[model samples]
Each structure stands twice: as C-alpha cells, then as structure tokens.
Target: MTYSSDYLRSLVREDRVHRKMYVDPEIFELEKEKIFKKVWMYVGHESLVPDPGDYYCTTLVGQEVVLSRSPDGNINVIFNRCGHRGARVLNRKRGNAKVFTCMYHGWGFKPDGTLAGVPMKADFPGGVLEERASGMVALPRVKSYRGFVFASFNADVEPLEEYLGEARRGIDELTDRSPVGKIEFAFGCHRYHFDGNWKLQLENQADMYHPAACHASTVGPDGRQFQRRAGKEGGDAAFFTANGEAVVAQTGVRGFLKGHSSEASLFDKEQSGGVWDEYRAMMVDAYGEERTRDILKNRRHSMTLFPSVDILIAQTSVRVIRAVAVDRTEIEIWPVRLVGAPDVISTDLVKYVNITHSASSFIQSDDLEAFERCQEGLKTEGAEWFLVAKGLGDEVDEGKGVLFGPRSSEVGQRAQHVAWRDLMGA
Candidate 1:
C-alpha cells in the first residue's frame, strides 16, 4: 500500500500520516517546492492595495504574485510575469493600473515595477528598458505582520516575526481586535475553489473537531448563535460550549513546527480569564481599561504559518491554502476587519466571516464533503495507505506540539502531517 520514494518516506510513522500524504502526485509536487516555495505567503492586505494604483491579483504557493499599491503609497510584490513576452500581465482579479499594459509586444510597466514606457521609444535603439533589478520580479521577500501582507520566493526566509512562531499571537489577537491597533479588509473576499486538497483545508482549520459533530444544530452551540431561544429568548447548550471557552483554553497552547502549527483560540480572552469581557466592553469605549487590558490581554499566540498563513485569531481570519494540484485547490478566504469592532460587531463580523466562513458555506458544505470524500477515497485502488494514526502513542511530545484532545483533536491533524512530512521529504 505504499508507493515507493522509500515507501513514501515510510508514511511518517512516529505518529502516522500516509494516505499517500493525501493521495500523492509526487507528494503534491514536493508541497509546491519545499513547502510552498519556502514559506511567507499570505499576499494581499493593507486594505488590499488601498488607493494609488491599487492592485490585488494573487497566487503564491502557486506563483503569480502582483499585489501592488503604487503611486507614492508604496507596496508592490510583483511577478505576474510580462517581463516582456513572458505574457500574463495583470490578468484581472483586481485592478486600478496606472500603467502595466504588456498585452504582449507592447510592454510598458512602472508603478514600482519600472520599465514604464515601451512603445517603440526608438524601437530598441540601444535596447535596455530598465535592466539592473529590472522591476516586475520584485519579491525579494515582502513582509507586513499586522495589516497581514506576506510574500516570499525565498530570499532566505525567517523574519516574518521569526516566521511567526506561536502564531504571532494570532497576529496579536487580530490587531488587538482593532481599537485602531490596525485591521482592515473591507468586505470583498469570499473566494473558495475547493474540490479539496489544500491540506484538506489545513485539517479543517486546525481541526476544531467538526463543531460537536460537524457544526451540530449548526455553528451556534454558544460558539455564538446556534439558535434555541425558547425558555425566554436564547443562550444554552452550555451557551455554545461556553462560547468556546477560549476554544477550550486553546487546547493548552497547541503546538508543532517545521512549517508552523496552532490549534485553539490564542487570546481574545474572556472565559473568565479576565480581559476579554466583550473585548473589555468595547475596548473600554475606545482604549481605557488600562489601555483596554493592554489591548485585550497582551498577545502571545495564534498561528498556522507554514505553507501559507492561517492565523485566524478568534476569527479575524486569514486562512489561505493554495495547492493547485492533486486535483484542484485554492481557498484564499481573507477577512480581518475588527480594528475596534462594533458597527454591530463589524456588521456581525461581516455576516459571521462571510456567512460561517465563506466559499458559500453551509458550514462549508461539511468541510467540502470531508475533503472531497478523502480525495475520492484516496483515488481508489482499493485504497492503499491513509492512516495518520490519530494521536498515536497518544500524542504528547509537548516539546512544542502534540498534546491532543478536543477542538476536534487529531492533534492539529497530527501536528499538520508531521509538518507535512518534514517539509515534503516524504
């Protein structure tokens, strides 16, 4: 039941994971080149190119970057090709281009990607249209911790907050739930193209154990809003599992690494843990309760930053998993508009993160039908190896991540496929 390459690198045994590592295709092209081209992905935020020539177009972990925001405001990213005939220069998905027209044989770029005018400026008189660091290939590693943003075709990784360990405290409890601590992404994204393969939606967002049996009675088990207001108008079912008691006190700071790891609410406090009382009663009416409890309990956790960030900080949401193979997957769902919530809780957290975590979700259609029926029964052949030995030897290495139990424990999907088989060596 193993497909060579040393039996798929011995299907990772110190705590299983070998359903052909989610049905291989050369282990999904070595996890898109050693874990999404050497990490730091999440590319698009800063209110998605706010103003100037604003741009957005995505894909990193699948190439094609683009990101832009030029015309003085700065923020570029680049690489949507067209370095003269490499074609595809901003093929939509976002726009406001003051200049990037490379509809082949016309060139012309600029807006921090230089080479701005090229329509026969003496038709190649001495032929050098902005060479030296020529532009357009600009991602020599981009950063942006707070307003999200990230990019890297690997110019030597590790810097995005030391590659976000302990999940940059889930981007500092999502920009301290914004009392101008910064958080923006004004209602736009809802994208999802899942048949399933993007690490099975990062093991269903760090495996929250299918919310009491796959979103039981539907996502409102006091996890907030799961209907049943009978005895006098709502609240019970232990008030939606005690409104996820800080996601069960974040399964004791869930851990794991090699790419990244996380599991459980990392501090949007308030399980009587003091400091998150309705985000300190609306950040004490705009920064007061000791600077709003040091802006909602001084940050310390939240992460999933390996093959492309997932730091969902109690729902500020940044989930991105773009594995364009093993069939098809690109669930880029981005949403972080909390900044100081309460426009009725940011319009009910933008309709509960675009209707219960977007991509037209019915609770995301039972996690896309259990990751597309486990990738169609591991693409049949009487199914050969798919065991991730669920909490094997009862997972508890605790050197960083293993102690597994609830929030649907497969222990963050076996510490994310043993850090995706040691960064795809399997």
Candidate 2:
C-alpha cells in the first residue's frame, strides 16, 4: 500500500503512533529512502582502516559499502559493487589491499575508488575506461568527527558536526575518558539480530522505565544472589546490585533535536581505592584536577545518535542498528578501547560487553524478548495506536531544542517519532 506524505505524518500523533509504523514493510522501504538515505548515518570508524590500503566492508542503509584508506591518508566510503558486472568487489570483511579486484571480471579500483585497470581493454567501451566512469562509486559525503566516520547518500545534507548538535557531548564524554583523549574500536564486536523493528532497540537505549520491570531478573534480588555466588561484588556488578528504584530515581534522561538523546549514568563515580585510585591518578596526570573531576563526574550511561547508533559510554562500546526488515533488525556492539589508559580498563570493558551484550548474555536476551513481544503485540488488530504518553506534559523545555525529563519518561521515544514523521513526511 502506498502512503501519501499527509498519511505518513498522520501516523505519528503527539501522544501516540499508529502501529503500522513498526509492522509495515512499505513503510520500512519508505524509511530507507526518506530517512536513512537523507541523514548522516554511522558507517565505520577511521580506526577500522587506519593504514593506507586497509579496507573494511560493511552495510549501510541496506546496501553493501566499504571504508578504504587511501595513500593520501584519507578514508573513502564506496559502494562495493563491481562497476562492470555489478558483483561485490570486496568479499572479505576486512583486509589490506591497494586495489580491489572484482572476482567476476577482474576490474580493479584504487583505494580512493578510481578505476585503475580492466581485465580486457578492447572489451569495454573507450569512454567508460578513459573517463573513469566505471569505477566503484564513492559516497557523495564522508566525514569523521574525532575518528568516528559518518557518510550520507544525500550530497546536500547538513554538515556532520551540525547534524550531531548537542549529541557531540556524548562523543566527548567517551573520548575524554581516555587520558590521551582518543578511543579506538578495538576488542572486536558482538553482532546479534532480533525479530523486531529497529526503533524498538533505539527507544530502549534511552528508556529507564523498563529496567525496573523488564530487567528485574538481572538487577533484582535473585540476580544479586547469583552474582554473590559467582564472587562478583564491586565494579559493574554493583550497578546490578543497587536498588532498582534508587537507581531510577537518581538517573535522568535528556533528549535532543533530531531524535538524539542520552541517559544519565546509572552508577556514581567509583570510590577512590585500588585500581580506581590508580585510574583517577592517571586522569589527573593527563588533565588537571578540576577538568578530571568534571570528566569523571559528568557520566552518561548511554547516548543514542538518531537513526542507527547508540554509544554505551559507561560500557565503552557502540551499538549500531541495522534495519533488515520491518519487523527484523541487526545490532552490532563494538567495544571501544581508551587509548593511553591502563590495559586493565580496556580488558574490563571487553568483559563487561561480553556479559551484557553477547548473544548468550542475560541482560541483552531479556531486552530482545521484550522487543519481540512488542513486535508480536503490535500485530493485533485490536489496537491501532501504541501509546507514548508517559511524561508527555511534564517534559521541561531546556532551551536549544533539548528536553529534560524523569528517567522513566517516554520523552526520548516521542522525540524520535517526531523526527521520524518529519523525515518521512518530507
């Protein structure tokens, strides 16, 4: 069924949204064109392809794309399709190749995505080879903010920094945590898929209301007992052992324009002792005492960069959302390493990601169950709309397109739909 712009806008009301937004395949196709292609989407980080000739193949907006580092020390995002036979040029997930040779026809492309040579010179048209028109197509816009690469299919889209807006604070918080002010997507990643719309995962990142209930088993008394049995007392386990109500009460949610939002830290700064003290000293040695205090105190548990990316600040990982179908989504969690920090810090981060986001993890599995249930429940014909009225009228308008609300509020989810309507309607 074709939906008009007016109808698309009507699907998202102030306090409720039509269920079709989550279950309609046509709407998902429309989202690919109107929302995903028109915005700056996270592709991959520069660290993924640091050296010249290094390349990493990944998906963006349901299309195969590659990030390649050129000899000029610049990274380029190019379509992975062969210019000759339309076959995928790069099959490997990552490698160091000066030229990508198509498996089908042996057509070669430089790291910068310029046509280099064709297998048979007389077989191709003269102009196609001479004009470099047959080269793999490079994305129109590719930019990186502090090593985090983003690409847009729309050439006329807003600048990356302006697009990030207040969301830059989240990135800053992650990078500043490193004494050298640099972070890398090291320690590999954990990739998983769920039978649910991409928005469900996006909204859950900033959601504080569901933790007390949805994650009760993980953070409740029973889970604490299990942790105690496993001899886990401090660190991240402390966050799980804390009273659910007390944690929710102390946390706050902040929403920004264009569907960007962040959840305040779930736990306070670690008490100064043992490795914690050593870490604090390292930070103090790098940044002065005042700046170090500010950096350590202003903690954000997670930050959702509209459309596809969630920065798990405290866990030192990034979750990238990829929409596979209207009711199916793929998520990739990449653990980050704080450069110049102690090896133990990075090691602990990887361990935390394994316990919380791995396919067999309890926390992530519970959330996936909820997401699947939401997908199934939305299929019922009995309900036409999904209510998102929690904290609807109580959101404080923190000027400059930011909304401040209680941790349990749906302000972030509402803001996302507002941006969705705007993009889909346009």
- Candidate closest to the true structure, highest lDDT: 2
Whole-model lDDT values for every prediction: 0.63, 0.84
Candidate 1 weakest ten by summed lDDT: 227-236
| Each model's total of backbone clashes | 17, 0
Q: Which stretches of candidate 1 lie over 4 Å from their true place?
A: 1-14, 17-29, 33-41, 47-50, 54-64, 70-80, 85-107, 110-117, 121-176, 184-261, 264-282, 286-300, 310-410, 413-415, 418-426
RMSD of 2: 2.7
Q: Global lDDT for candidate 2?
A: 0.84
| Per-candidate alpha-carbon RMSD to the true structure | 16.7, 2.7
Candidate 2: worst-modelled 10 consecutive residues by lDDT:
225-234
Candidate 1, residues 165-259: lDDT per residue as tens digits? 65566667677768777777777766767675777777666665455556554544235443121112211123143444434323432545554
Candidate 1 structure lDDT: 0.63
Q: Write the per-residue lDDT of candidate 2 for residues 126-236, one digit (tens) a residue.
A: 666652458889998999998889999999999999989988888888889899999988778898899999999999987878776776667544443112101122354
